[model samples]
Target: MERKHKRLATRRAAGVAGVVFAVLTAAAITLVRTALPGGGDDVTLDAGQRGGLRTALELVPFAGIAFLWFMGALREQGGRAEDRFVATVFLGSGVVFVATLFGAAAAAGTVLGDGTQDSTFGSHFAYALLTTYAMRMAAVFIIATSTIGRRLGALPRPLVAIGYLAGLTLLVAGSGVPWSEMVFPAWALLLSLNILWGRPPAAAPRTAPA
Candidate 1:
């Protein structure tokens, strides 16, 4: 394999690791929820289960940070935003989006476990998770942008555009929801696309540090 191919493979591995960690975190949360010791009928959730779920969900942001670190590697190897214009736009938006997620996570994490019926740090974390999830939609942008002007040229630009628009629509929907739970299935699909079927873009040219 060529050197560029090697780099893409490496980056793909890091991304897949990030995705796998995130999915496992979600699985832990779900399992904790289901394992709540409740009888057959509709039941009150146990504090332990709720805390376990929160604890599991809390780990997810770190997974996202790890994924961003992988993306950072891709960017470090001279991944230029302008390489794919639409993707560049989304990436720029993603920079701000993830930054917000980090901030929100930090703020809520500082006051962890302080729950109120009105709005708790837990509630804020839920919102932050959904916002982070909206950030997940960026992968569609990443793949589409990265694939453009390449062999996938036959694929319509509008389709990618619409997919992103639709993702944005979903992002705006269902606020106050901790959607990190919901996106894992879709995240798995995206991860597979990157892993099983990616056509690595050309390695970005090396640059002199300013």
Candidate 2:
């Protein structure tokens, strides 16, 4: 009984962490997009824009930290039913996604500090790191997570399908696709909500190793 309660408590914490990770990441991305011009045209950001960028930079580190905690919680929930190969892939991709995301944010911060509209390389490079590399890793991580959830009966079939679709969209969509990156956070939001809503019962059995 004590172990069961402990497990439930852990799941609740993880679920909340996942929601926080999604919201923080989404807000940071939105702030950056709103602050910087979307096109290739070089334009100087006004005071408001600079303020937005600064806020975004500040949010990113916290988002990354929350995501790591969310990952730990997710894996704990999965327990021994998780396949070694897929679990490894999921963990690796998640870590890489966070690293690339931070790198992109740092690059963007550098560009913001320089305030050089003519030097667009940093801006372009940061977007590439985010959309191309980070999101691709995110796609893989999502797919692996969905698979694990399905195997463990942790997620519903509909949610699993949505996960697959979201992953595919992230994998196929390029940087030019407007709001494409939003799918990741949206999926995370839904998943977190579901986890919170259908929390494990206090008497539920502890997960057993395969």
Candidate lDDT scores, in order, read: 0.48, 0.83
Candidate 2 C-alpha error for residue 63, in Å: 0.4
lDDT of 1 by residue, 103-152 (tens): 54454333333334333444445444444554455444444433542323
TM-scores of all models?
0.54, 0.92
RMSD of every prediction: 6.7, 2.5
Position 32, candidate 1: lDDT: 35
Any runs in candidate 1 off by more than 4 Å, and if so which? 21-45, 73-88, 107-168, 176-181, 184-188, 197-210
User: In candidate 2, what residue range of length 10 has the lowest lDDT sum?
Assistant: 199-208
Candidate 2 per-residue lDDT over residues 1-210, each given as its tens digit: 796777787788888999999999999888888877683234367888889878988999999999899999888887655789999999999999999999988878765655575347777777888888999999999999999888778888999999999999999995768678888989998998888998463232457668
Deviating ranges (above 4 Å) for candidate 2: 39-43, 117-119, 199-210
State model 2's lDDT: 0.83
TM-score of 1: 0.54
Model 2 lDDT, residue 25, Cα? 91
